[model samples]
Target: MDQKLTLNGNPITLTGYNINGNNYFMLRDIGRAVGFSVAWNGSTRTVEIDTARPYEEEQPADSVAPTDGSRYVPQVGDTIRCPDGTDYTITDVSRWDKNAFVSGPLGELPQPTCDWSSFPEIELPAAEVRHFQLESGEYLFIRNLYETRRMQYTLQNLAGNHPDTSKDGKLAYGGKGSPAVSIKLSIPSEISAYSFWPWRESEIENLFHSCPPGTYYMEAWDVYKDGVFQRTEYNIRAV
Candidate 1:
């Protein structure tokens, strides 16, 4: 049987045999397809396999094709897009360095690292409002912007005040932490991007404990240099 195989976006062919209604593939064919080594030891009368060694064709050296330079090799700081439509920046390329190779036919290779945290900082056209749901079942509002030293935020219930029977008939207020609360944060003189979480997870959970399900308004201002830098608002739903 002829089998069509696609490895790393490249197509190849392999021969397989049907045995007892199951397709069986040769070990040598599988190793060559996956770039591994498979050899038979006549002296020991056993089969030897080496995963560290790459598969080498027995063809003449002249048959090896030269690189056309059309393929792009990723280096440190180079951003590449994955097939899944996600962009990732190369953080390290030490694995490709000649110094990483050992004195052996098959040298150990180091794996490169690509971290999302190491990606370049995002540049926003304006202040952005972000939300995170806490494990305590409360939403934490985050204000992301540039050049921020102080953050002032307010949460207002748009559905007005009401009594929450779930919390001992407590009178739920429209403005949970109103008049507006402000918090001071330290900003380095060299850094500008800032992300501020208005309230702690526990505090947010407590604030909404007695509040009923309704639409709420969240307004936040990024204050720096003794004035407001940017203001953003978001409509939140509570249940």
Candidate 2:
């Protein structure tokens, strides 16, 4: 028996055999053809299929909310776009109450007055990274990565010893604390070309802030349907 296989309208070459006038595909070959993981557990006699990628879950704008007890607390300088398409940049934030103050075309207004937070939910634009020069003849990389998982991000010098370790001595996700860390740079959603300080106020608590000059590992995880699917890694140098 002969049949054509297509994935997303694209032809896929699969290693299959015809048995009793029926087509049977090799488990590993089928998994490889579709970018899936095909593994057998001898003890359990079960196979695990990880369909993490190529099937991204789409989330509605209103569904982007901080989970329960999430460490991602909105800080000063975070920008938010309301449902009405009104964009506001947080100019000032109260350290005590954690309220943000915003400025717009009219003028600067209190956090509540802007009504940006009053909306059911707001969105952070795509994360980005930019570099700028200082009076000291030094360049700094400003990470505009947001706390949301809508897009991916990379960073360096933040990987620490964890309780979770794989057979190869690699740090896995599960541990006593969150494997992911929050970035707190004052960088805005959009960086300007001529602005001396393109990024917002520098955050002292961010691990990248005042980090020693060295090479660091950067990683970003992909989220699907509000669940973390997988993570990617990169290397960045801080000078």
Q: List the residue pairs that clash in candidate 2.
A: 155-218, 186-200
Instruction: Write the residue-wise lDDT of candidate 1 on 1-239 in tens digits.
Output: 79888889999989989999998898889998999988764235367889999986533112111122122233444433323322233344443322322232222221222222221222222332223234543122223222121111222121112233112222232355321111222223343332333322233334445463433222233211111112122112233
- Off-target runs (Cα >4 Å) in candidate 2 are 1-4, 53-239
Worst 10 residues of 2 by lDDT: 224-233
- Residue 128 lDDT, candidate 1, scale 0-100: 29
Error of 1 at 160 (Å): 99
Measured by TM-score, how close is model 2 to the native structure? 0.21
TM-score of 1: 0.23
lDDT of 2 by residue, 175-203 (tens): 55432333322323343211211112222
TM-score of each: 0.23, 0.21
